[model samples]
Target: MSGHQMPATESVWDYPRPPALLRETRRITVECGGDVVADTTKALKILETSHPPVFYVPPDDVRTDLLRAAPRRSWCEWKGSAEYWDVVVGTDIRPLAAWSYPAPRPPYELLIGHVAFYAGRVDRCTVGGCTVLPQEGDFYGGWITPEVKGPFKGGGHTHGW
Candidate 1:
């Protein structure tokens, strides 16, 4: 986690606690079952210690008609409760593939009703035309692009981190 190790990289360890938001203009596109579920150049990235960035696209860019409310819900200490969504495209259905904080807590009010898709669950997720790699762990929804560096914390032996 030493910054000296990789001069050109931003260590996740150096990222702030409670997370931070970075607005990006890179083209972000999500596809599922041959259909474009989301496409936008305006996206907000969530950065936190031990994790890659999680991009949240505005609802206007997402195909809401393809998303159905899921039964599951989860809570975050900083962001508040999250509601899941099942994406349906053509005959394909990916349940709990996306999530949103319809009513986020303070400091995260920007994320309200904004949608974030799990790269691992979707057919493909791209950033600036480069397909993104999903964070190693099953639970985290971080997207790993070449511009991001890791020793990321979502994989094995990261529980205590």
Candidate 2:
């Protein structure tokens, strides 16, 4: 919706810094290479300022067999270190398509064993039966559904925000 926030949609600016981890009951699903990689109704969503919510599905709900650890790691000031994962389905592979905070810091310890996928890296990701738009830029993993409005960070020129 560009710079304007739509009615009934949550503005990203209203989200908190350091992020808030909240339980989400909406169905979350991820598919890639013709297979459903993850599906869950019990997910945790990270709500951060200037970003759309990022959904994290418990490992038990994901097809962990299809994921291979990638030799990549990243740090989040609030969530702690993240380990990347590659999704492999037969001969098809999507590198570093998902990530998790195996040992999250305080206030984020609930993220342990939960995985979050990059919507842009998978064939499809749906929240409550609605396909989501990926947050812009390569780094952020936010999922943009109809209820979340944004002048989101991650797009070019928004890095300084």
Candidate 3:
């Protein structure tokens, strides 16, 4: 990645202009440390396109202190075998809430080493003091933010996730 900083004029958002397949909602609260930025249920063909329901969170939004890189790894044809992270909270830890393709495929070069989180795993998923609603099944994270409006996962025949 070129390592260009995000433009100052642009608001920090995961998908500023999501594809026709995606819909996002945004809200900010406290989760990791600085803020609990929430974007709710997004993407059409999301499972097929974006590595299976994982919510792409900007690293700044997550609590890095609690995340420890783990030896465990898994691979995908698109991105390499992902390196895993174990999230530590208090004395307890959830083995996996984060993943990254350090050396990604050419098409996904922008996302290399950029971690994606599984909202389904982490225990504290709060947005604006309210614990956000978890989506059906193990959808990665379509955070619950008012900005998100969608039939993202429920459109006619949208199943097969």
TM-scores for candidates 1 onward, in order: 0.91, 0.94, 0.51
Over 31-130, each residue of candidate 2 has an lDDT whose tens digit, in order, gives 9999999999999999999999999999999999999999999999998899999999999999999999999999999999999999999999999888
- Model 1, 63-95: lDDT tens digits are 999999999999988898999999998789999
lDDT of 3 by residue, 63-147 (tens): 6677899887786665556788877766666676667677866555555545565555665564334454444444234544333
Give per-residue lDDT, candidate 3, residue 27.
37
By lDDT rank, best first, the candidates go: 2, 1, 3
Residue pairs with colliding backbones in model 1 are: none
Candidate 1 vs. true structure, TM-score: 0.91
Better of 1 and 3 by TM-score: 1
What overall lDDT goes with each candidate model? Answer: 0.90, 0.95, 0.48
Q: How many residue pairs clash (N, CA or C atoms closer than 3 angstroms) in each of the candidate models, in the order given?
A: 0, 0, 10
Candidate 1 off by > 4 Å: 1-8
State which candidate, 1 or 2, has the greater lDDT: 2
After superposing all C-alphas onto the true structure, candidate 1 shows an RMSD in angstroms of: 4.7
Ranking by TM-score: 2, 1, 3
Candidate maximizing TM-score: 2
Minimum summed lDDT over a 10-residue window in model 3 is located at: 43-52
Model 2 weakest lDDT span, ten residues long: 1-10
